[model samples]
Target: MSATTRPSWTWTIEPPDGWLVVPSTATEPADAVRAWESEVVEALLESFLPEGATGPDAPDPDADHVATVRGSLTQTVGSLVTFADEAATEGARAMAGVGLLDRGPVPVLVTVGMGDPDESDDVFMTVLGAKGGNPVSPPSIEYPDLPDGDGIKVSRVDIDEATGGAWVSVAAGRRTEFPDGVVDTALVWRSQDLVLVPTILDAIVDLLPAVKIIRSTV
Candidate 1:
């Protein structure tokens, strides 16, 4: 396996540009992927908890539930076991990093989890959709740009009514041919606050049609 594997990326939106893309290279691909999973879960829990509700000094059951959910999401993503060669590893490296795109007070947390097809299948579900007997309700939002398949899924969760903050996540799958077989790719986005849900949704819808993935041997 290549020691420093990284994938190239192309964005769909420009005016809404300036997303600071970060590659997960702090450690090996597998370790990096795990680290990202932990961070994403933390961000999610932060979004769900009431404002000023958490502190290292206090214990909260709600916070515990959020933590459990994070673990679940990580396990779900990690369960992808049959992805294309090195794709998971390489893509995970591409998934790391943060970009702050401010649209007035609403904050958008953009996450990338593309891994090499030759590696592991962990991040595959995020884009290519998941394979199993599990079923989820259809999304309230329509993503016309997303291709239909088990690899792509979208949903919205209303977290807090008092503050009106909601969470929206998009798992888009892409396919690229490799010498071994066809490989899949995926990306995820989570909104920080209530006022930003619609904005994030719109941005994702507009950006989906423009995302491009390519496999290289050079």
Candidate 2:
């Protein structure tokens, strides 16, 4: 596809990479970035696979939405990691299909499940990138446009978002050094994206306050 010829599908170009992903974009607010990523993943899943082939067998979806629509959903949530692993598995399969894993673009897999408190600063999240299914070796580094004190801990996970699958990149700077004592939750920020399950949707609806926009019928 040529840049001059805009495809029917939405296309965004990355700085030096081949494609620019929405979740990987730098402008989104940190608070809701992960949620936004989940939303896009769900939509992609819906776009692919047969109606009944999604749900439990598909990528993890938001819990809040699940409860309300579960009864009517064609798919089910087999387990918590269903969504996370599914996304990775799909990405690998895609790379393989195109014969690219070894020589093609590297695959990035992220778990939106739960951020590991051990490595991150908060309970909210910490984004992680796995290349070819393993934690990205030598973690990536992303620098600030202007000289800043410290840069984000990782680099972007570059992957083409395929149906039902998400593309994640590693970034540098989410990690901060602790001299020797326990640190407070205040230390952590959204940059360290943890794996978020579809269950998070329920958390959002129940207590997690967020500005929600409803769709309108034109």
Candidate 3:
């Protein structure tokens, strides 16, 4: 399909202050991703640097800590990109957006997609099933009130031993059938601070209603 006539989806949420949202759609430009990475790197340094550190006393770009942070961020971004590509290969139209938390330098990822109902259900079930044998708690399901459609949300958290962190994953789908397929969305938050995960999940849930499916045509 030509760029002008291809249909695309987008979210319409107004993110809270201190949050930066970067578009990761299939059509998003490479330069935009690089710019986002730069912004995130700066935010992370500012958050981790000593309170009074500045100017000549700042950490060197070649320092181990700086490199570690950059490497981690690169891996996170790369994983999300690969995921979106895989979703497309499954006959789904998918796009992802990255949310950067300035103070904690935390990363939040949200993905929206549309595909056959059976295929989408199978994919969601696979994710839920993978959590079965782990020590993490079981996934929770809830019906959310949405403006335009009936909504169902499933959420779970997985503990990461290597980093002593946790990843909270939420998959919310609205029963809105389009000419092409059904609409679904997923949100993921990664953090080492267990105390903050609940607050972040609450914010994610509040924003779920703002997700809208948009179809574009020239």
Best by lDDT: 3
Write model 3 residue lDDT over 92-171, tens digit each, in one string: 33333334343334444555656686663666444433235353877777777877666666667777778856766655
Mark the 10 consecutive residues where model 2 has the least summed lDDT.
92-101
Better of 1 and 2 by lDDT: 1
- Ranking the candidates on lDDT from highest down gives 3, 1, 2
Q: Taking the tens digit of each residue's C-alpha lDDT, what string does model 1 give over 24-128? A: 333337576567556655654455456655567445766776567566645533432212122335434222212324331122223243345577664454332
Clash pairs of candidate 3?
Answer: none
Rank candidates, TM-score, best first.
3, 1, 2
Which of 2 and 3 is ahead in TM-score? Answer: 3
Using all chains and alpha carbons, the TM-scores for the candidates as numbered come to 0.36, 0.20, 0.54
True-structure Cα RMSD, model 3: 6.8
Please list the residue runs of candidate 2 whose C-alpha ends up more than 4 Å from where it truly belongs after superposition. 1-140, 144-173, 181-218
After superposition, candidate 3 runs with Cα above 4 Å error: 1-16, 23-32, 43-103, 117-120, 125-137, 157-175, 190-193, 209-211
TM-score of 3: 0.54
Compared with the true structure, all predictions reach lDDT values of: 0.42, 0.29, 0.56
Better of 1 and 2 by TM-score: 1
Number of the top TM-score candidate: 3
